[model samples]
Target: MIRTLTEKEIEISGEKKIYGTLARPASAYTDEKFPAVLMISGSGPLDRNGNGPKGKYQLNVYKELAEYITKLGFITFRYDKRGTGKSEGDWISTGMWDLVDDAELAFKFLQNHPQVDRDKIIVAGHSEGTIIGTALSERQELNGLMLLSGGVGNLHEFTTYQRMLTYQELKNSKGIKGLLMRLLINEEKAETKTQKQTKKIIESNKDVYKILFFFKQPAKWIREHFAYNPRVGLKKVTYPVIAIHGDKDGLVDPSLLEELSSLVKGPSETHIIKDMEHGFRFQYEQKSMVNVKKMLKVLPSRPLNPDSLGVIESWLTKYFKADVSSDIKENA
Candidate 1:
């Protein structure tokens, strides 16, 4: 029988009031508690639904995952970033440490929830969330961890890698826009500019940096992320861990999945799904940062890659059994 799902608004108190949503199956035993997954979103100003500022990024990744996991009988909690949605604080000024604090509070909230199985709670972090989750695991004990679209590298290393790839894309462009880009951009010069900007962001004490006196960049966030290494915390994880990445992902290197698997001391597995992008959508064209951004324009109309979901489901069931049916153990 298909299970019915339920959802409700949840508020978590941190430096400011953090707004979120909790999802679970409707049917339950009198004394039964369900395994839970506390979702941490990737970098930037995102909400519980995994959307970005001004509805520009309407990628409903977390919302889709919550419903999918709830059907398998696990309660999931996802919250808005401080300063975005209904949460308190200014997102532009919120640093990486600030996000980690909010995630820690979310974890504690799950631990005390009446219907949640405290011992079976898992953290499912996506992209930047992977960094926050790994750091949190080093400080607290969790049943398992699911790292999605994240690597075992510092923000600086990843950004450098991304810049190289985006430059390659610009070099291989075939259209008039590509011609203009090729003529206007010098990779060597761009790298120099990037290095200078990185140095400025690292040295500056300001929360935000204004470029051309109009565009604002999160200085604190960049500095903190550049300084923290996800691998350091991954080394301390003794619980079951699963890392997933899309081979077609343009934002993050998929090879990082191997490094993630090797760093964790406990039982772990890694999977790289084909045709899946960073946003969890299947990409039909060549995967590039430019194409990824273009695809985001229609993210709402796309479906989450089934292959990626299958990998996650298989891994979750293999180690942490959920309330799937009478035959499966509720907590394993």
Candidate 2:
């Protein structure tokens, strides 16, 4: 039998109105409630469809994942971050906890859906969402969690490690750019400047901070995230968890998958796919944040890595098969 999907544009009321799309199997099952997945996007001014501002970034990772999982008989909800898309508030001023609140509200929206199985709801987060979902799991009892491109460290520690890797790559560059960088940039001074900037942000009381007297950043958000330790909440997560990272994911260390999985008190699994980047697409070239903009320009054209999707399918089936209704399972 061919499976069809029913999608609806919905809103969840909270401190601010949250806009999102919910997709579910269209099969008739009046007395049955299907398992559901709430998707939390990575850090960015991203929309419900996972596109960035004015189509500058069009990696539709969450949208594709939601559609794929919905086809597998699960209802999936992906919402816009505050101040982005049709959602309310200022993204630049929104703190990390605010994102968590929005996610919780999205979860409650799923739980309250007539066709959703309250006990079978799962939260799947990518990159930044991984930590947010972990934090949410501490607040809500989720059936399962899927952490993509994220591991078990605070943002501060992770960013410092990423800087080190980028520095090493730049230090080894083989041309004029390398010569100029080495001549003009002192690693020790760079580190000191970064430390000073971080200290300023942490001590600031402003919601937004101006850098270079022009560029604005979400100071409160950075402050909150830098201090957040996912280990505390992850250690309390007794629910099944599956973490997937790409071997080429430059933003988050893929090797941390082992530590992340081990922290979960419940059954857990991890996968590190080759050539896959943080965006879930395959990138055969050297992956670096320095070339992120250039890479993102081509990422939307590339399809998601088959192995990553397969792992998600396999893990969900293994741990949450009972959550799917009989008719939906039959179709699968």
Candidate 3:
């Protein structure tokens, strides 16, 4: 039987009461302190189950994975990212560093839970969550990490590729992404005729300026992203890790999956699922929201990568099964 589990909204670090959920096998009891995972969302403000704005696809993914983990003898805690759903904050205001620290906080929170094995904590991150997951695990308290649809390339490069991929398809049409990128990157500032005017008016803020000045070409940020390198962060990940990539994923370069595994300095594994996309939806056709439509059609309970959930569940089990020891070598 699927147990509803426990949850509480916690206010941490900012003016946000993060919505958190803990799921376990129905057979579990207070005395049964089990291995638990802290689930973190990617770049956006996702709800407790991984859905966006107010969706449940992410929740489905987390629950299904948690169910499998529960059946395999584990528990899971998935939370709504700040600024989304029951959480407070504006998605636009937070950056990567802010996101990473939140995941770390989740870990710290889970550590105090009575039902969780204090030492058996795994941080599972999907897409952007992967980056935050890696950063958290590097701190040495987490049991391991699961990077789903994680990127091995740089953030700047990935953002550009994503924008271009979508832009190319809609290029002929006003190309809103391109227009927005231009507004953020160049044309608006160029139109202003001076950095002072550019600084005051361009809603992008000073961080954008620092990043732009890094390349000496604020307008050339696209170039930096086009060549963005995630190797720096990927290399920094030195914990028990698993990187999963869906064969059907159109957003990320699938070829980098193996490379990410090789780059990790610890116990690691990679599973490339045959027909999954960014949302873990099965391949239906190129660029169709039909998969999402099909997913949403599934209703109140949703599942992430319906076709590949087993792979994620299994890998998680194998990792948690690793012997725990502070004296153990940090690198597996």
Off by over 4 Å in 1: 28-30, 175-185, 324-332
lDDT by candidate, in order shown: 0.84, 0.85, 0.59
Per-residue lDDT for 106-201 in model 3, tens only?
Answer: 777778877678878888788777766765655546767777886566554444455445434443334686576545554334444544533332
- TM-score attained by model 1: 0.93
lDDT of 2 at 107: 94
Candidate 3, lDDT over the whole model: 0.59
Error of 3 at 71 (Å): 3.8
In what order do the candidates fall by TM-score, top score first? 2, 1, 3
TM-score top scorer: 2
The best candidate by lDDT is: 2
Q: What is the lDDT of residue 68 in candidate 1?
A: 86
Candidate 2, position 116, lDDT = 89
User: Who is ahead in lDDT, 2 or 3?
Assistant: 2
Candidate 1, 1-332: lDDT as tens digits: 12577789998876899999998777546466889999999988889999988867888899998888877778899999998889999999999998888999999999998888888999999998888998888777888999888858767777787888998888778889788878988889999998897788779999998777888999999999988988888898888998888877887876677676678889988888888888788877778886766787865687899998898888777777775552243333
> Would you list the clashing residue pairs of candidate 2?
none
